[model samples]
Target: MDSIPKKLYHIHRFDSRSGLELYLSGKEDMVFGEDFLKFPMMNLHYVFSRGFICGNLLIDFSIGAFIHHLYSASNIFQDMIIMKFNEKCSMEVRRWHGDRTGAFSWTHTKTSVEELEGKSDETQDKELNLKASIKHIVTCNLEEENLAHPLVLPLADCVISAVLLDVISKDEEDYMRNLEKASNLLKIGGHLILFGLLNTTYMTAGADRFHMMKYDESFVRSALSKLGFVIDYCAVQRRRNVSDLVDYSHVIFIAAHKEK
Candidate 1:
């Protein structure tokens, strides 16, 4: 890919509660650090939405439903990009759900290789090759192991993904694994975007104790730099006060490119 304008792919959802919606809508009046810049066009891949209720039904339905709506509403052939990753089967199911939602098409793949190849190609068709040319790419992930999947590493021009709420600090091994995955997935000179919470505690439906990683801009930069990524941009923002109890304090987004 030639060095063209940076194309940003947001790997989050478009719900009123999630900060992503505000950032994309330009409602958030914050700016990146002096050294940071914005991508040309932002494309969002939503894994879940806040429309559904927050109990068991919400968890079960939103996972598949959100992606379905996102694919239906979005133009896959856009310049910028954003994506979410679950395991192979879950991702496949999401594709299927998206097909049923509206004017989208989905093909079920039985094998991991098939799923990876299928989704990656589908995403590329919508983003990278839109103008019959390859441009800058950025991918974000929420699942740690998903970053390690064969399909994820090579497809992304830049990878930006992170572990779940409690996985980062509570489980050191898991955090290291995620970092390793991010390092391996990104190509030399590719960028990686990261997001995480700081100093908060919450509980999931399964009674999982969730704790945030007390990370700031410098801490994140140092960590990624150790893995051979150069910090290009870093921004920290506070979550808005809302009725929802989900503690979204200390929002952080990073743009880091791998060194040759």
Candidate 2:
């Protein structure tokens, strides 16, 4: 299987050397980087792997890219607000917001509003009607079904959800079902971003007790198209080599927009 793609082979070879190399190799096997402190470097590598710039900067380049894309589309200049669901103690979002000032409302299963409030004073410099300026909201909701939640499709301009359809339900219909629910959340011309582990286990955050539905890029793209989402951009993120203590592999990021 590994011999098919020469690029994959080179990635594996380069990943066999240092701690970072080992981390990338492990990502290919299904392990996330353990050290959150290294996320800045990890994110930099992620951007670089996607064919972007290289720098030790801790700014939110991901959000910057997203914002640039959004700005190019329209002229909404109010500060962008992100309603992040299920985000851990990751600084990617905050780093993306930076000191420019904006409102960021975060929701997670493990923390309280007070805890999130402590971090809000610095971010909420001005309040814009959230439903207006936010061009996208990326979520990591890997649930069995798209449930009736306040944060569903009807509430945002765009929603990005990561669902492991195969491992969680083992039925293609189940995957489609959830995908439909996600699509209904958008308006006539909103966007939906979907990502999943390809041919890998259902594991995350140091836990290895769940199931995962494996998928390839073609399968995901077809599924999205069936649900009325036109593919805008799709790419495979090469898992980085972090350290020899663990092993993992890669995942795919797909961006699709609803057609009017």
Candidate 3:
């Protein structure tokens, strides 16, 4: 007799709200909480802390409605353009930016960012600073032939994407294509900063699981090299939080410039 096959948790369509409330909102708890925040928080701080070419425009394609990563960048960039996959997420971003009701509090994340910068006494000043720097929140579709069409999406000086490719890519082919789309949005010689959750197959957003591309550090390097990006910094941090939230072993942060 043939045995029943194991059910795949990666089947469910990615529910963005559940993910927003659970991990990405910066609310920490004992079980499977804060790990999502833990890995990228400090690493992003360090990367945006210094180095790389400074620019006026920064394009962000981060996971969920995250803004903590922008604090460090605020010191450098004069303008920031956020790209969201859908309208709902875009509204949430706008809500946060507008200081409206029901907006997730990122105060803790901001506080953490300040501490990283060695600040003891602070206020809403830092958060307000970041809010002022946000120039636009644009919606994007990956399937569209011209990804940045209809909108005046200008070539950016730098683009930063955190765990986005792994979340959206169905396979290596999709990964490369999505990568190329992002690369197109960047100016020649501009930097592309990537935060990859290595070896992750799926991520549990609340109780639902979403497919994540399984790739390693070597693959990321090769992908960037294929695009003529001269790698400048690559830092790999081993998994810090053990949870069923995401089956990732390492978090890889890479900063590279598009040479050609």
Candidate 4:
């Protein structure tokens, strides 16, 4: 299996919120961060508009980092469950959901969602909807056979996993193991919304470095197919800005469904 050495990485020490801010709002950032914000949100909006059912149970395995996708997903699905691999990510999500002070504000994401929907004046309403839609936020181990151990969660209709596998899996085999775990949590014919970096090996959070499994578009399709998922929609965007934070060549998104 082709991969990077884990000895040089510190994935658990990653700051989820700060990373989101840097990727989404940093002026010096030339990366396709804006594309990240727009592409997924727009696709979700189109999915909703087409009367696509996101199902009653929506499991977000995104480690609760950036809420741009979550905020959009909230409106279409009820009983939303978010999971994180570590305590910091879980706590940060709880703070935001609980409306606690000093929560990392997602105002930019909110504004972007609203403007895209042509309902810029409906920010507060959307916030309320999001708050109400989230049923729980908990810690999860993506590497585990059961992501959330000791707490058995019902199979979900849709699972959103973004920017997670790349950083979590040390190799293609580990990536498939984690992906199978996520797939096991989904009901038959359930959808999997995946987002990640393509051909990227590493990322930075402050001074800490982390390993990301480098992979390309074909790998995504082949892996999902091997896992018995039919690729529904797939797209990729090239990076706009070169930054020291990461070395990803393209941003990839895939909408797939379990076929058997």
Candidate 1 lands at a TM-score of 0.46
TM-score of each: 0.46, 0.45, 0.88, 0.91
> Once superposed on the true structure, which residue ranges of model 1 sit more than 4 Å away at CA?
1-97, 101-155, 162-174, 203-212
Which candidate ranks first by TM-score, i.e. highest? 4
Instruction: Please write out the lDDT profile of model 3 over residues 186-258, one tens digit for every residue.
Output: 9999989888889988776655566778999999899999988998888887777667667788878888999
What does each candidate score in C-alpha RMSD? 15.5, 13.6, 3.6, 2.8
Q: What lDDT tens digits, residue by residue, belong to model 2 across residues 1-260?
A: 22222221111112112322222223435244322113222332233334322211111112111222222111222323343322321233443345234323222101221232343453232222222455444443434244433344333455544432433345567668756756765655655655455655333222112344555677788888887778766666655545333223555666566774
Model 2 earns a TM-score of 0.45
Candidate 2 deviation (Cα RMSD) = 13.6
Point out the higher-scoring one by lDDT: 3 or 4.
4
Q: Pick by lDDT: which candidate is best?
A: 4
The superposed Cα distance between candidate 3 and the true structure at residue 165, in angstroms, equals 0.5
**Between 2 and 3, whose lDDT is larger?**
3
For model 1, state the Cα shift of residue 92 in Å.
Answer: 8.2
Q: Identify the superior model by TM-score, candidate 2 or candidate 4.
A: 4
